[model samples]
Target chain A: MTPYDIILTVLTTLLALYLISFALYIVRVLKGPTIPDRVLALDSLGYDLAAFMLILSIYLNSPMMAVCALSLALWIYALDIYVAKYLEAKEVGG
Target chain B: MSEMLPVIMAFVAALISIVATWLAVQERDMLIATLFSALQSTCYALIYYLLMAPDIVLVYLPVSVGILPLITIILIKKTERYEE
Candidate 1:
């Protein structure tokens, strides 16, 4: 087995692990007993997905796809702030 | 295995997306449902990336993951948290 094959195997294994956790996160999102629980799961899923995108870019052999990971990382935080304020019964925004 | 890694990843992501959509609609709480919608959007964005459509991911991330959830949560606050 060459070194390149070893690298590909490791990447595929990691990607499989991420996908498995992704499914587990979905289960948590589904069976969550509270709104906050569900929101928290969703938050983790977003960030996890961004990481998946980065890995995918590497697998795809393209640096351009990394930009999606960057923007996706930036955006999901808005959901957290909005939900927290709404739960606290405070003004969400102007 | 190396040759088909992207295709396999995309398939798994697609399945997750379907499950997320089902969970989102099945929720009794609007807030939780909205959160699930965000998850669904996230899966879609990943699918976009897997399909090599970075441009779509750019628009989808901000609009679907960011703005859509924010607006929906605000509307939920104004309406009702739990559905009857």
Candidate 2:
């Protein structure tokens, strides 16, 4: 097979790997005893998903789709910050 | 294999979303349920990317993952943590 096919295979494998982590994150979100644990799991899952989107953009040959990934990462980080502060009682409705 | 990559990703995203939606509904804690809803939205964004809908992804991520959860959490803090 060509290098392109090989790259596709690699990307597909990476997608599967990220999805596995996604599944584990779901489980953690379900079984987590504390509020923070669930939030942390959601944090990692969002970041992993952004990485997956980046890889997918490359595989699909759409450089514009990476814009979605970038925005997702940024917004999720903002959510994390808001949640963290909310947890700390620093902000009430952030 | 290359041609089928998008199709495969779409299928997987669908499956994950189904499970995520169910998990969100079943969760007892409002926080965990909100997190699962975020996960469900993330899966939908991936589906949009797979389906070549960049505009939707741009809007969906910030609205669902960012704003929605923050609003929900604030509501939760004012109310109760555990669902009853």
Give the runs in model 2 whose Cα sits over 4 Å from its true position.
Answer: A1-5, A90-94
Top model number, DockQ = 1
Give candidate 1's error at residue B12 in angstroms.
2.2
Report, for candidate 1, the interface RMSD: 1.1
TM-score, every prediction: 0.88, 0.84
Least well predicted 10-residue stretch by lDDT in candidate 1 chain A: A85-94
Report lDDT per candidate.
0.81, 0.81
Residue A19's lDDT in candidate 2 = 69
lDDT of 1 by residue, A13-75 (tens): 898888888888878887888778887888898888888888877877899779888898788
Report the C-alpha lDDT of model 1 over B1-84, residue by residue, as the tens digit: 777877877787788778878877887877777877887788788778878899988998899988888788778767767889
Under CAPRI classification, how is model 1 graded? Answer: high
Chain A superposition TM-score per model: 0.89, 0.84
Poorest 10 consecutive residues by lDDT, candidate 1 chain B: B1-10
Tell me each candidate's RMSD, in Å, in order. Answer: 2.5, 2.8
